[model samples]
Every structure is written in C-alpha cells, then in structure tokens.
Target: MKIFELPQTNPLSANRTIPNVDSRGFHYKDFETMKPEDSKLGDAGFYVGIKATCVYHSQTERIALHFLDFNTRVLTMRTHYPYYEEERFAKKYLSKAPIWRKEVATIDIDILYENDDFELAQHGVSCKDKEEEFLTQKVVRRSARDHEFYAGINGTWEPVVKNYFARKEYDNYEFILKHIRKSNVLALNEEALIVSQLWKKRGLKRPMDSLLEPFARKIGTDKHHLFRLTCVAIFLGHLRLDHKYEFNLRTPLRLRPDGVYQFSRGVETAPWGF
Candidate 1:
C-alpha cells in the first residue's frame, strides 16, 4: 500500500502550511470552491456545506485519514456515496436556481497496483495523452451556449490535475477490489479523491473583476443577497456542479441538462426570493 506522508514545507508560508484534519472537508470552506459528492457506497456524513456528499464502499475511514497532514478552507461539507440516486432537496425553495458544473471521472488505479503486465500494456500511453483524454471524457464538449458562456468572459483553461485528483474515483470501485486485493487508505489504494483545493498546478484563471456585484445590480439586488440566493439555487439543484474545472466569481453562469428554470414572477414579495 502507498502511504502519502505530509509534504515538508517552509515554516513561514501561511496558506501552504499543512495541518492534520478530518477528511470530511470541514476545513475547506473559506475558499470559493465547490464540488459535488457523487457516490453511494460508504459512510454518510457532512462535508463543507450542509449538502450530502458521495463516496462509495466501506473505505470511508481509509479515505478520512488522508485529511491529516493537510489543510484547506471549510465552511460546510456533507459526504455520502454516489452510486445511484435521484437528486434530493434539503428544501423546496431551491427549485429555480442555476445549473453549474458536474464532472464524472474514472480514476486509473491500474497504475497504483503492482501488476507489471498491466503497467507494460498501459506504458505506451504518455501522461500528456492521458490527461487530454481524461478531460475530453470528464468535461462537456462546448455546445453553442457553452461557447457563448466562455466567450463572454474571455475565459481560458489548460490541462491541470494531470495526475492529481482534488476529487476523483472509479465508476465501480469494486473493480478495484477485483484487482489490488488488499486494505489500505483510499488516498493510496484507491489512487484517491485525495489532494486539497490547490495543487502544484491549477487549470484556473480567475476573473480580474467583481462579476457578481455588477450582475447583482443588473438584477436589482445587492451582491450579498444575490450571492446567498445563488448559493441556495445551486444547493437546491438549480445549478449542477461538475468540480472537474475550476471557477471564479465572473464565470458566465448557465443552466444545465436543459435551460434555466423560469419561475412565474407573480406573487413573489421580493426579487431574491421565490
């Protein structure tokens, strides 16, 4: 089994310092990052927000220990298994929100194992080709509207998380059971949904200005109130989250699987509420 010891860092850097914590992600909230828990196979618990997270199999405890020796921002994190289930609401008020990003990726634990034959067979694949194929599979191809969304902001992206998974997993992790028959931390054995919010390289270029404030004004609401409403919309399923790509404040928001849900504007007492 592979053990990921905490990286040794300088004693002075503030944000980069590592601290042992729980894998529940309780320590990763202050930063503007979002991820969807898409599993249904392990222990259920809260993550950064009051949202339900996803993890599969009985390897939860193994996964949790990796939280040690690292640190990140956290406000709320709800974790669960992400096998098969319908979207559930923590409340009814979130019906008309926006759809965000959602990424479904298959991690190659094949490399993490000791199968020399598999390695030689897969050895011909270059890391560069592997990452490109991974993105093509995980990120949605740009639709007309997707093109428009990125164009509006002059956005840019590059292949990041090449071998690092801020979050990642297999479709049928039992597949892992069929191969690397052993017990160890998921951080190593599973090839892990390991790693914190930031890494040595990130595929994000944050917008330079305040996109939320300006849009709030356009919609006749203050940024704070609008921001909260947006969060609610996301939590309520108005927005879908594919954590594969990184985002900043000004990313042109769009609905997914379909278009945005437009609720009847009548009888609503406030602009920010239903």
Candidate 2:
C-alpha cells in the first residue's frame, strides 16, 4: 500500500483553494467559481481533510491500498503576545521595537503504505489483514509548535516569549532583563501544576523531592533549583504548551540552554513533563 500526497486546502479562508490535483476529484480554480455549499466548507475552519483509494493489479495478483492523512496547525501568537512582552519588559528596556503580529500557515505531511500477492483464505479472510501486516500506515496530526520553523529553537514557550521581547525591546536592555526575572516566578507556578498532574497520573509520589529528582537528572542540573525554576517558567508561558522544548532525557543534554530542554528519541527521557 502506498500513500499518495493530497493537496492541502484552506477551508477556513473566504476564498476556497486547493493545492494540487490528480484523478480523485474536480479541482476548484478559485473560491468564486465554487457553489455556495462548497464554499461553506472554506469558511468552516476545517483546513485539513484526507482522501483514500485502492487499486489492484490483475496480472500480478497484487493488491494496493492508499491512505492519506491531512492535518493543520492554527497559530495564535497574538493571544500570548501581551504576556510575552510583559515578561520581556521590552517596551521599557529595549532600544529596538519588537514585532507583534499573528501568523498562519498550512503545513502538510504525506505518507504511503503497500502489500504484495497473498492468498486471501490463509490471510484472515480479509484484505485488511494483508494490508495491515504488509502496508505501512501514516497518521498526521497538528504540530504543537508553530514558530520553530521560523525561529532556530523548537518553539519552547519560554524562548518564544523571550525572543519576542528581545527583538522588540533590544534598546531597553535593563528593563528587559528585569522583566525576565519577574516572569520566571509566574512560569514556575504553572510548571508545578503541570508536573504534579504528570506525577499523579503515573502513580508516583507528588512530593517536591520526587518531582525534582527526575527533572534534575533529565536536564543535568541541580535537581531542586531546576525544578523550582521550571515550575516558574511553565506558569509564565515561558514553557508553552505548543512548544516542543522538553527536559527529562536519559542522557543529560541541553537542546536549548535558555529554553526548555527536550529529550530526543531512544534517550530514555522521563515523560513527566508532557
């Protein structure tokens, strides 16, 4: 089974648009040309959709199933900008002005899955079984972080806020510095709540020491201090929900020294921070 790429569409826009076309369906040239009902799908905010199809080769006795997964990431940067700016204290301290605006984009992930000749009777009496064993399935979901593509960091909550402030208030260095310290306090509070929930879900002790132990080893830092600081960062949105930054890896490594720490795959990282 092979997965074919489906054109991405922005159903949320006033103008309905489709990215590409093959043989699956009729392509709309523009929003105006579409019927009223068809156009409604555009305004519905369902930016992502999927289409799947299957084909068979008679001579080869081979069966193929195609699956397409569509997903969208809606970005809302402006909602957090006020808090971001406050944390940076950019307006008072930075010499340079920061840019405050929201950006939206449609991203796509395409995958393919396949199967060869097989006896149906022996293979659980269904094509799905053959396809399941031989074919690879791909699932696509919205990305948690939006700014990482534009920014160097992986869109950790804290770093994004800091970056925005830094850019906006570069000239007001003193004030920005002060705001960062203050922001840390609020972030930590939120972090504590999130971490506590993670611990409870895992049936672990909720004591401060238990929480601190995993974080300390994960980040390769002082367990108690880092835990306290992390909690503050989360509360302030310094460590954001959509940010990909994380700590708690098997190996002690800092992906972002200034932002949240993330553990890569097969690293035996602790999952408490999620």
What lDDT score belongs to each candidate, Candidate 1 first?
0.26, 0.26
Q: What is the lDDT of residue 158 in candidate 1?
A: 23
lDDT of 2 by residue, 201-244 (tens): 44133344555677666546576555555434432324322123
Q: What are the RMSD figures for all models against the true structure?
A: 25.4, 24.1
lDDT of 1 by residue, 111-200 (tens): 111121211111000112123543554343422233333234332112212232232221112222222223222213111111111110
- CA deviation > 4 Å runs, candidate 1: 1-48, 51-210, 254-274
Native-structure RMSD, model 1: 25.4
lDDT of 2 at 106: 21
Estimated TM-score for each candidate = 0.23, 0.17
